[model samples]
Target: MVLAWNGADPSEVGDGSNYELGVWYRAEVDITITHLRIWTGPGEINVTNRRGRIWSSGGGALAVITLPDNPGDGWTLHALTAPLQIDSGTTFLPSYSTGGNYGALPNALNANVPSADGNLVALSAANSPTGFNGTFNTDPETFPNSGFGAPFYGVDFQYTLGHGDATPPRIVDTSAIADGLQVTAAAVVEDDEDLTGLTLRIDWGDGTDATTVTYPTLQASHTYATSGIYPLLFRATDSSGETANRADFVQVFGADASSNRLNTKAMQQALASHAMVLGNFKTVSLHEPRVRPAEPLHVALWWSTITPIDASGLAVTSARVEWLLRMYTPGEQEPQDEMDAIIGDATDRLIGSLARDFDLDDHVVDGLVRMIDIRGAHGARLNAVAGWARWSDGMSRVVTVTIPVIVNDVWQEGAA
Candidate 1:
């Protein structure tokens, strides 16, 4: 089933106003509408006149149904006798009559509502400043021409793809096995329809072209010359072009793990086994101990909260957590370069909170990786200070950890 609006129910309900209320929407691809739905308030009565309707851009009624009385406080679906086929990019309105109390969320339709299957309820002001979430003040059902405050009136529809495929391919599981410098990746994929033409593509995330394979042969291998952590992306596209994607990570260890050098796993294990708790969070750093000058120094830092750390007071809805990694010369007081990121802020692109990303129990470790350039440096004496800070005051809420950075002396052989 496909729906134009997938958000939670509206928080507010209005009085029993006899108005025709609905939203205007379009689909990315051709779709067939099979049912219309409305939100009925609890203990709502007099539902005999409750009607569901679909109107074209020209105010022509395409489909109409008399909704059955439902006193429940949730969505109620009403099937249409004949499925209505809507062309792509065609704008239409799906509405219901508010014979009794109705549910609405003001300013909810300010942005477009897009379903995973490609149907979209455009912004309330897309057509005109007063056009999308329409309302007509009349007892009889009619095409609503005026809108108010971009409110969502709890009207939606169920649809299916015109191509007859109602479901997309699913990537059930993914795995990556690293053997030395080579990593083998595989996935288990299934589709509701036939999998005759299913295609699987793997992006090694090392700036290489993705590897594609057909169904029943969903495995691929890649070899890297350097040791680092690589993210593996798997995407499966079915015959109908419906796709599903999954991601995993592969850590490659270099052939040499000498005293001066440590592998990715070794560094991670060393940091994890140690009791390194900074304030309310624990951190682990993984990187090669030695790197060549001008080469990208890949570092992955894992952190989780040891306790409930709230940067903002209880009065604020949310707070920000900042992560900083600074590189400095040994015995120096200043950093040569640094990287910082802020989370839990309104401007954050990442979706989640400190509690969501890092469980207080610290069972799950969330990590961030960065590549720092060490150009013009030839000595084996460098330091990296990593820690977290409070975004409000720019102060370190967590104790910082200093790791050694050793640049190999290969670049100094021909330099004077």
Candidate 2:
């Protein structure tokens, strides 16, 4: 993804009158490259190994004009018939020249790029039409007092890791533990390229339906209902259907009713149910109500419990949990994704009104309030109870509520 030349400069030109101009780029380690961007016209453009062996050519029929014709002014992308693996430190010389007199398009020129390898540009003696056949650094050469001010031409390149790599993803780590009611198994998956759309399948040895998932995230977790020593298997498959797997990867032990703790399975099920309910709402445009693809929502749940005490502990408060919900609009890529974040404040009019005696997770409650306030048709079904106390010492139980929300991407789509 690196560009060898500056793209922001608003100037571009072909090799004026000169027979040829080229840059010799030294490759670092072995690289598999697919294409290079160059400004070309009626003449030929070519790549040669350190020994000057032709590897790729844009034109044919070696008249003076050997490369293909470029019809436009900007840099044109020329695909190398296939990926070529070049060894490290190998000098790759890419050049463009005038085969039929400097008419139409010459090679692209980045006039004053001081960082260019000045030694790589070779010129021809006057009237020497052959490429790179003449003098070096003598034709209109600008050698500045500062070593960094010499001019260089422009070139860009692209490479891919999937070129010749056939190895499958490897499982780096695995762990399992009994959390409340279920056994949670986690695995860390990795690949040479760590690319997207790789399929991961988790086989919970307890005969549960194996889960198949695809995402770029390396960490994955699954919970089993009942527990014994359940062996787990993780299999990863690339787009090429080449799969690498780890068998009997991990063993998880489940918990029983006697394990005194908040029910993890119940908590997971509750959160999953809430996620499904929120995902069911269709996006409604503020101008007109219409259906569109639903955006992805992330739900996080955290909780803490307190031990209720009394001579007769019949009215014991069990636990308190918080749910945080987020929505990612489609076409909103990371790093460049624009987000409108609304921090939930105790004094914010819209969310502050919802603060009753019930102690809601302020963060999650604020996100829910913001989700509903966006410009669109929004609705929610919520139930809650204020702090209810039933004790001689008067310790109130914190009430929790369920709130489902759908984030409409109508604005994002319009912006796109």
Candidate 3:
């Protein structure tokens, strides 16, 4: 609700006549004034911008109105209807026959306004809605001493600025984690766009999921209650409204008590699958090839990997592993090579031996079946028939395919 007055000085009367105004001049183009008047007192003071903004009180600070650029002698004829700081109105007319230079003021509108306390209010100006900000140190108005026209009404205005790829997700380690211990298991989530918005989720491989998790720093310490394998999954999102999800597997094997009884050798090759089954390898009996052992019991193998972990990338060397296969007839006091021959078939001769269960902490029937299997799908023995595959499972895992040792008429194999 910016108002304008069109004269250098307020209309004043000293003795018999009112004060005459100065010549005409332009302020902003297209705006003009012919008659103007100024009286003292308070009245309704409205402030607004392009749209109506319902506003609060001025608190006595007046919405100082501006006068026209071309002030003339007819200014004194305009009369006031109200006071200085309040709402008041008085129409002005041209003194001469030529009439005043402009038409009447436009409609009163409303707009949005804010208080000095930072609270927003509704204001009206030209019957539309907009926003207005109130400042404490508003500029004081000064009645011009001498000028062709008055200044135009203006308000300070200020404007908020705010500120994310197709990067695909990747799988780092599809392995498993142990239980009852603080295992650092995690994956990294990334995006082609802004990487900040990407969130990481952890499925803990323990049958529970947590979306509040994030990646690149996946360090969850959840212990499994029982001994089993667990699989972990992860997903990511970007700021550009793009999402890339990735999932890797991990296992968390548990025991009756947290101890180091697990075979670390076998665990290295195991991949976690849905929190179940770790160190995915099997063992049994088969007739394939025995490099060092006698022809009585041969060995078959299937695996993959250019260089096995033990081979250390082409350092090619033999790996010896121990097998505890129950001789078809244990404690018969016969040599292992002879027993392997006496043993018969696919029907019932072979069994998942737990013969040592009769005793405590001691291995019963044992055989040293050396194998050539490396580490991979094809190289891995599991890729072949599930025979009594005997392969190394530790740092120095060795399967000694015993060559027939007939000493002093006593054909006895090495004690495992």
Candidate 4:
């Protein structure tokens, strides 16, 4: 299920001084649970890994405030979720307070919530006199991006329980596969949480690529403009953003009374297990673990194998993926020569030590994986660093490079 939080103001505020979210501001909240049967008083909600809470004011109202400065969560600042529990068939109208937790509470939204509606249920507001707005850059807003300038009672991602249907994708029906144009697609998309991106593999019968949608479930059909019984495949992403290959949707084109039946119906092998390495941007040291002068920067490597492979013996083959170096803005003098030296050293290390035997296409999930650190030799540069990722042997090639980054001073990425 998709949860969206948006920011706005009440009609009563004429000066628009409300919800500016200055240094601090408490918020009114209304929460609804769809397709579930559960109820309880949520003491607190999590936000940005921080925690916040709502409580009953002396005037039969709910009050929200940031956790103690110490927050007891072992963090100076936390990402918290606001949990304003509303009872069954009851509307909860929460008001903001002029105080944090110790002072008097004042509400911005008139505390007239209609909770008694049989179809209506839970609601509460967790606010601090302090504002909980987060900064933002330009992008047509979308889910995953928490609302700007406001907190949804401090919540990130939450899945409604039992909102998923345990079903893999299937190709229930389709029209005849054609020579120049053949269409194949999923028979249905169903889920408990809620269906998400659904993808279908389409083979145009020629050597052209197997058409695929990185994000599926949104489209209903795929057309191939070439001839051949391109083995078609199917994969569906679940509400929680998990993906699964639906081999049941495998089909073939060019199948007739002339060809061998099995060969005519080759499954979309391309829709095999997939893997993705998660990446994040964080503040880190420029030396030691990741980047080192005149040494290969050994970065933490992780991956989710999409296709199943017996990597018991496959060695990881790597190439000079990325070679980069960046420091603060400089003067008229350039550091090009220093950068060339740093990158040149990194290339030597990659050519010698990188794993050279493995089938990346058949990567097994949680199977044998490799990790290396960029370290220095006897006497190396103190601050220069270079890094790279393993590459496939011109086979199973996706992007041009494994560590698709190279050159020092080319990126501001201090951490990989």
Candidate 5:
């Protein structure tokens, strides 16, 4: 999926301009690029020494391939020596140099191009500081950032759905319970590829041997000798050996104590569903739908991968989770009050000890809670946005969810 435009012939063809012409674009998801393509003009046939290149937004060459000397007068594709992985939400440039006429369509990239696999948006002056269509010296192959008008220079790339099996399996919709001396855990596990050899491991966190099971069977039970609070761990491994881990806190009540005090039944029912998904990697659920002006809001965020994202061997170093809260008058566009927090580095000062690390050691089906001081009038609405960002790249991937909250000094039944 990432293509500059549809496979239609351009309406205009430029005379042999010995310059590199291409499009600057961004992908909505991670993709593995295997080939580069260029729309050749009728006169471009038999042209020799045609070269194509993929460049980073910062002007670094990523991959270069030579087109066939006798490419047909249509879309010409050249496979790279190896597949190149492109991170989601990052910009890149794909260009080709030919001392022959090139096909083009004016103002074609003013908006996103249509693709079946993934979203590909052309960068323009309106949407991007780097602009969209561009040209540069053909011989030296410098980054193409000079053109304008959002023209389609016919440069494109072919990519697969994701970074292959580079991504680990996702563990979502998890539920755990510890009643009396027996503990039970379950999760919905999935991977980018087949789960033929996937395995789920459960550690009761009570100094006992962990329980292991295969895919399609995620539920595990363990019996403890004493009644207490125990940490439960769940780990899933795909065929590629990539693994994802999750944790939960289980409480076992003594004989005289009532298990109903913990409300395990209601918590388990809630864990079966999620309120929303953030950045396609984290699932979120609201724990407290209604809160007072000065009270705190609680939400549970379950990540598909380990916290402090391990984007090693990629473009960035580290990543952090962030959240933003906005309160507004019933139907107003402007916010009356707002609060935000970042849950990685710089967390200590951002929210003043409210930034809690993801409970990888113990997930009590709790929320990442933060106090919100609503200054808006009564009957205000609340919306929450959360996402993750790369520390080095500064590119954020976010998602927004609207959760109803009633902020008032007087408690009223059915008042929204």
Candidate 6:
């Protein structure tokens, strides 16, 4: 729908030709134009020529052409030479200017209502009037002053759709994440003209309603309410009425023993997601040292970045991360009772360290621990132990286990 002016319709026609008059409109969506529907005079008007043109915000002309005159007046559809693409919020002037040979081209005056868009003026004072000599301020075309008063002239101009190169927006792949965690869904969309006019619609496929966004980036995040497979669909449309679609899948899981598997891909994904919570680190390496049956469970996490560890953006440090990994994999022990004491001490030390050195809270630390349990549920459980010697010295160890957590330069922190 176009040209719905709120004010009362005008009783008589206004002047056009000579000094050009056009209506300024802010496009709500990207649009491509082939012609403009301009309402003319109510009485029989003789018109040898009609020009439909557009000007940039700076009073520079972008496109202008002589339109074919249709018999009678009410709405005249003026065809354009080339398709003009108009982006949302881009201000441009669409009007009909007079030619060398002055003809009767009456500008239809709608009711003088305030412009719908703040920018609803008919003429720009910056452009000087032109005369027959093709020069400004010459005879017959004196400069128009005081003509630029407020309550912009009532003019009716609506755009007709033209050919637009509308391509589907490409939805970026989301990283594997655990349930209750936010995952950002991003996309890449472009057009022959400005991309700002493109709108993206995301259907999360979780039985919820779909969402639409304009000029969207890959930063929109959604947290799955439960663990399951979600089909992702994205549809992108441009102002010119062109559209495209793409589909993808997202797998979400919760922290459960049944969810943990000895799969290499799953292990890598889980570890990467966990390490990412440490904020922006330079390098990350997850290693599960071969564990003896009764020996202390050990997993090594090594990460570094070019930036200082204490930098404002880099919140996690090597010391803090070491303490976290220990909590997750503290290995099994011979006597379960004795093992509990060692685990208790380790937990206390973690809290003490935070209280004394790092000003962090128990609740925050507990949240991190929960993330580890859920993200690494499929991996071997690490039992907390004081030392290898604490294990029964005479017992023979039956099995060895290993888990690797690796992160490279591509690591990024998830939404807090």
Q: What is each predicted model's overall lDDT from 0 to 1?
A: 0.56, 0.36, 0.26, 0.26, 0.54, 0.41
Compared to the true structure, candidate 4 yields what TM-score? 0.28
TM-score of each model, paired residue for residue? 0.39, 0.28, 0.26, 0.28, 0.38, 0.29
Across 231-342, the per-residue lDDT of candidate 2 in tens digits comes to: 4566777543457665432323345432223343333333333332222212211121122223422222333222222212233223323332222233232433122221
**Which candidate tops lDDT?**
1
Candidate 4 per-residue lDDT over residues 1-416, each given as its tens digit: 32222222111112211110111212223332321111111221121221222223222324333333223221122212332333432322222211111111134222222222212312223232212222111221111112233322222222232222333443343333233344544335455433434454543334566555533433345554432333333445543334543322222233332221111012112111111111111111222222222212222222211222222223422221221222211121236466445445444433332222121222211111221112311112113333322223111101111221111111222344
Tens digits of per-residue lDDT for model 3, 1-416: 11243212222222221221111111221211211232311111121111101111322212223332333333222212222221112111111111112111121112323222221111233211112111111122211122211221111111001110124444434333444533445555443222433455556545565534543444555655564333444545432234544444433444442332222222221211210111111222222233323222222222222221332123233232222222222122246465444443321222211121211111111111122222322232311122243424211112322111000111122453
lDDT of 3 at 310: 38
lDDT of 6 at 395: 28
**Candidate with the greatest TM-score versus the true structure:** 1
Candidate 5: 10-residue stretch with minimal lDDT? 272-281
Clashes of each: 0, 3, 81, 64, 0, 13
lDDT of 4: 0.26
Model 5's number of clashes is 0
Q: lDDT per residue, candidate 5, 237-268, as tens digits?
A: 86546798775556565664433122223222
Output the worst ten-in-a-row residue range by lDDT, candidate 2. 140-149
Candidate 5 yields a Cα-based lDDT of 0.54
Error of 5 at 221 (Å): 59
lDDT ranking of the models: 1, 5, 6, 2, 4, 3
**TM-score quality measure for candidate 6:** 0.29
Model 2 misplacement above 4 A: 1-30, 33-56, 59-168, 190-199, 213-216, 238-242, 248-416
